[model samples]
Target: MQQNSLKLNSDKTQLLLIGSKSTLTKTNNLTLNIDGISVSPSHQARNLGVIFDSTLSLEPHIRQLVKISFFHLRNIAKIRPSLTPPTAEKLIHPFVSSRLDYCNSLLYGISNTSMNKLQLVQNAAARLLTHTKSWHHITPVLKDLHWLPVSHRISYKILTLTYKALHQLVPPYLSELLSPYQPHRSLRSTSARLLFTPTSKLRSFGDRAFSRAAPKLWNSLPILIRDSDSITTFQSRLKTHLFSSAYP
Candidate 1:
């Protein structure tokens, strides 16, 4: 910063130490001295509209999302009675769905409990659009709306990025994280489109990383979807595959 002639904004700056729960617990109260300023670690910090906690569980972000989503849901519900289904859906997508989908690829390996909280928000949004009763089944409503569940939505985002990375549509930093699997010897399955999955010793943390998760998800996809030549085609086929698995 000094070399770049950029002054630090101490008031707006935040320090967050990311690590496993055990490691974070042991390092509580850790502080850093930067240019004669004593900065303490925050349990959570906001970055690019996403909240990250010390342990990277993302519970803080989820909680904030749920709160904001419900606030919009309530506002939308107030006027849903006067709107057509299509109009209601259009309104909800921007306020609720977009927030759910924003940076959701980072949510790929979150706990089911956290995912359920987001699912409930989507369920409420779907119900608001269709005027469904609270006791009614949400799956059928979601399926009718052609909306993938929260989990599948996360996968869709990841797979889309993976496709872009493979095709050089994304930055080199992300593209370099993935490598196409090439067999040393020609075999019957040599035509299969697959990515080399890196070994991850820390399943809880490392497996959720884009480098590991992207390959794992990409490999699990059918060859037709993986072999798509264009991003548009890949997204269309990818959604159908994920929707089937989600609703099946």
Candidate 2:
């Protein structure tokens, strides 16, 4: 770093061991020495806001998100009585929803158990904004707000990036990972183009990769949506489809 006119900041540097639970347990005490500085392994580390754990569980990050979101939810609930619908929506969105949405693509392939942790926070936000009772159903409220649940929200982010990459709108590195799907036989739908889905077994890190998940989700979409005329149109139609299926 010094040779390149850059300096390493030990204060901000952290070393994390990433692997499966079984792998991490065998080397729990592992450490590293960089530039003669001894650095201990961290169970969890945050980089550019995404949190990664030694076991790659992401449980710690979701817990923190739930904690902070409820704090904002409580504050919003107290002040919601005084604010109009639009104003309450404005405040809760940036405070709560934005927190849930930021860098959420990393959450792909997380267990439903983990995904529900974040969904509960979103459910609370919906109820708070609408001044609904604690027991009130959140399905309708989310639909009215045009918000997708946490699981779909994560998929939405991934699909959006994939769409950009498909159109050559994103950087070359991202575009390189995606290829236009070619059928081995004649197809009836002229506009239906799919992404190649990589096959992998479950319960491994490779199964959770964007390369794998992106194509799986893309292929699951309806033919018309897969062949939308533009990104804007795709987004509009995609949200509607997700909203209807989730709420219906």
Tens digits of lDDT, candidate 1, 1-248: 78999988776678999888777778846777766788998889999999999878899999999999999999988988899888988899999999999999989899999999999999999888888899988899999999999999999999999999988899999999998788899876667878888898877789999999999999899999988889999999999999999889
For TM-score, the strongest prediction is 1
lDDT of 2 by residue, 49-130 (tens): 7788887778888998999999988888887889999999999889999999998988988888989899999988888888
Score candidate 2 by TM-score against the native. Answer: 0.91
Candidates in order: C-alpha RMSD to true structure: 1.4, 2.1
- Name the candidate that leads on lDDT: 1
CA shift of 113, model 1, Å: 0.4
TM agreement with the true structure for every prediction: 0.95, 0.91
Model 1 residue 52 CA deviation (Å) reads 0.3
lDDT of 2: 0.84
